[model samples]
Target: MEEHEKDLEDVPDMNKKNSIIESGEAMDQLITIDGEERITSHNEFEPVPLTNNLNADELDPETTAKLRGDAIGDTLYSQSFVLKTLLKFADLNWNQQFEEDLCFLWDMTAEKSVCEYLWELSFPSVACGAVAKYTENRFIEIVIGTLANVLCVGCDKTMTKEEIGVIIQELDSDDHLVLIQVMRFISSVAFSSSETPFIDEEAMNRLCFVLNNSINTELLLKTLETTAKLTVDFKLDKNLVNSSLYNAVLTAYCTLLGSAYLELDTKDGILACRYMLENVTNICGYIDRFENATLKLDITENLDGFLQEAIKIIKYLSQEENLLPVTDDTIFFMSAFQYIFINLNVNYSPEIFIAISKILYIVSEIRNEVERLFESTLELECFLISRSTKQRIFKDLKLLSKHKRKTVLDVVLENGPKFHFAFDLKDLKDEVT
Candidate 1:
């Protein structure tokens, strides 16, 4: 036993540090566990320099072009691979690392040269798949931002018919995030590109679906903006009478107005309301032009029905229960009425004149609901109105004298403050006579 104890003590202590070697140098300068005098040179294990990685002189013209193309292609391919992998891994519980990875890949592919390929190769499928499969807001945002960037880069044919179909399909998603991203992408493409992207019938129906059903304020606003952009060039009098697109526009406007009435305090809700009101003014302007041309026998049948719809929407929105009495909120309503009143004239359709007259009377009579709109003044006057307002009213009234519509004259006299009219009843009579 004493001999064994002595042998254990005599054995070299393995834990003791060896002065011949240190950490980080063992592989570089080979050192055995057993003490040795010789050490292997680091140069023997060094990697060979890549002298032939790229040799421009050894390639033909086709090869050279192919290589240049491959550089972009390879980059897009790698990015798409990474994005797909990350998308597969992404879920509700995805962490910041995955987000960073996706953002990095998106940044790498956001360049114009790479963006088209990236969009064509994988983005559409990946985006739809992510929306359908994942509920991660961060992932959706990254996908949306990336797509917006691609659109900004000018994707002429980047989206195939199938891809557009997929986007339309995703619009039906119950997930608000998915719908938002899809609409945002569509809006970006529509506004950014010089050419209008082809939006099919089914897509239009789906947009109407979103408008009628979506409760998300932001989504509703985006839907309205997209629909307006799509139909800006529409010939309302000729091509859009009772058409699906027309009905869609009407439905979207009504739905948005209703929502705005309900949720006035929220920023998006107010914006949606204001946007629809502005659209109404624009449509009225269009109808006014149509009427002027029709008066010269250039066209027949004034679009009185369209004008009535505009006025109805305005009146619907003007209801006391639907409005917010705050100065900022009422400004849009005041602007709408002022715009309609200034545009009304003697030559305008009786329906239009009646519609404007009714709205004016409502504002004047429903003092309790819209009193705050007129600065809480009891008098229905524009005496304190700005010079521009006075000029516009005078111009519209001059035009009204030409048509001699009595209802318009009476409504103006009853509701309009006496001092606001630039010309009086006698002047209107003299002009008519």
Candidate 2:
């Protein structure tokens, strides 16, 4: 085979590198045990460099024009040889190493121009048990981090969104783990300190398509988590956060909540919601973190609007009527709302706090039985006292002793019995203001 074809093979082999190398220290410390597989160079395990062998001068003009095709073909051919060597030398007893190797191979395979490679070279189930054999949490994190870096580099900052879409669609499998890795790449790139790489818009636009097309809930859950994180990292700016991608993620989270509402595995739904909550907090915090006085004023001026939308989302989740037995989703909504409100209050955003108080007061009035309903939910009282504009909460809550309450706090807290009955504990704050 020509040298270019060999290069194509090496690209996809990166996946295997990711899987094996990422399995943590055990796999990291792996040394050839014996046999034909024994390492000849103990100190130098460099990737058999493919670039050095591919001489551009050797390619005819016609072939040189087809850089994409030639590059892919070469990568595939090179990886094929590596796969064989790895499979042969693999130790069945050290399954973790084996699995890591297989996953690494998959990562590499997916990087190739061969769209069909994923289906063709998927790691067999037999290898699964072996790969996870010696799993350690810390090792898993390191391996994942390493794999994320490889993907970021391999994606070649220049890939158009369209190209990325095509590649993702043609990926070997709609595998849950594979999607998780991809999502990890997206999150990392968004937050990476290096200048933001040029990502193919066409490729990113396809995120919703890929997500909607997928059947794996585990993948969906992880995707949701990653999306939530991105929303925070990107501050939910429309330009920074793709609307299609964002909506698709929110839709998925809502879907999970709906499907698992009554199921035993609702924890997945709860966890997904928690992720969303954190993002909201991060976004809100960003407004405060900015040092520019003018920028800060601008953010603060519109803080009420942002908080309102977030409250609406929380309100949806907290709606007891939406589910049976009022799930952890409900509790999570309360907790998240309580936490967010506390932040706004401590930061002394009276405008935003009063806005929230107004909304909760409206809810209290409309949902007559609702007040009695969540009376045992400790989060409600914590939020009220934390932002206590109410005199009682300020006077009673040890934490609120230094804070003062306006008349608005009094008006709201005066009807304390209606709200207090539902709390899980005494107010966490010293004062209502």
Worst 10 residues of 1 by lDDT: 1-10
Per-residue C-alpha lDDT of model 1 across residues 259-337, encoded as one tens digit per residue: 3334544555555556555544444455465554433221123334334544554455444454433345455555654
Error of 1 at 293 (Å): 14
lDDT of 2 by residue, 253-298 (tens): 5554445332323455455566655554454455445532443444
Q: What TM-score quantifies how close candidate 2 is to the native fold?
A: 0.36
Which 10 residues in a row give candidate 2 its minimum summed lDDT? 1-10
How many clashes (backbone atoms < 3 Å, residues ≥3 apart in a chain or on different chains) does model 2 have? 62
Best by lDDT: 1
